[model samples]
Target: MNEVKLIDMLSYLEPELLEDDYIEKDMNKLKNLISKISESSSLITFNKGLRSIIKIITFIIASLLVLVGIIVIIIKKKKPKITKKAFNFVTN
Candidate 1:
């Protein structure tokens, strides 16, 4: 084929080679997509961190509540079975 026809055929197959506008648009679209992906990943990291912190706080609160309940139960009860043994031991 002639050089002119070969060039035309190649250009028709690859339109971006013939137009600056298409190249610019393609670059802009790629940049925007990259930025969106970066932002979404950052958001995911933040959400995971927040969820981890919340889980740790919830576990701590549950443990403290259980400890408090056990203490209260032990302190609030009165038993009468130990007085005689205590008096005999003290007298001996």
Candidate 2:
């Protein structure tokens, strides 16, 4: 059996967005939280550490997700088939 995620199908529509690249929603909030944590932690300096790198990566991903979602939504809305023929074929 071959299973593909919704994101996988959407990636095909975008030439720049690869299937391997996952951009999550609500990531902006999470990025802000990470920044706050980094700032509050004296032991961890995000300015010149791995945390900074992670923050930047997250910000990029979040931006991408938002952009893709908006573009796709404006294009069209996706929904499952609900006709009797569709159900009959599934039961067969």
lDDT of each: 0.85, 0.72
Looking at model 2, report the run of 10 residues with the lowest lDDT sum: 75-84
Give the alpha carbon lDDT tens digit for every residue of 8-73 in model 2.
766668765554535554576789889888777845554458878888999999999999999888
Location of the lowest summed lDDT over 10 successive residues in candidate 1: 75-84
Number of the top candidate by TM-score?
Answer: 1
- Candidate 2 Cα errors over 4 Å, as ranges: 1-48, 77-92
| Model 2: lDDT to the true structure | 0.72
**How would you encode candidate 1's per-residue C-alpha lDDT over 4-68 as one tens digit per residue?**
99978776676555666877899999999999999999999999999999999999999999999
Residue pairs whose backbone atoms clash in candidate 1: none
TM-score of each: 0.62, 0.32
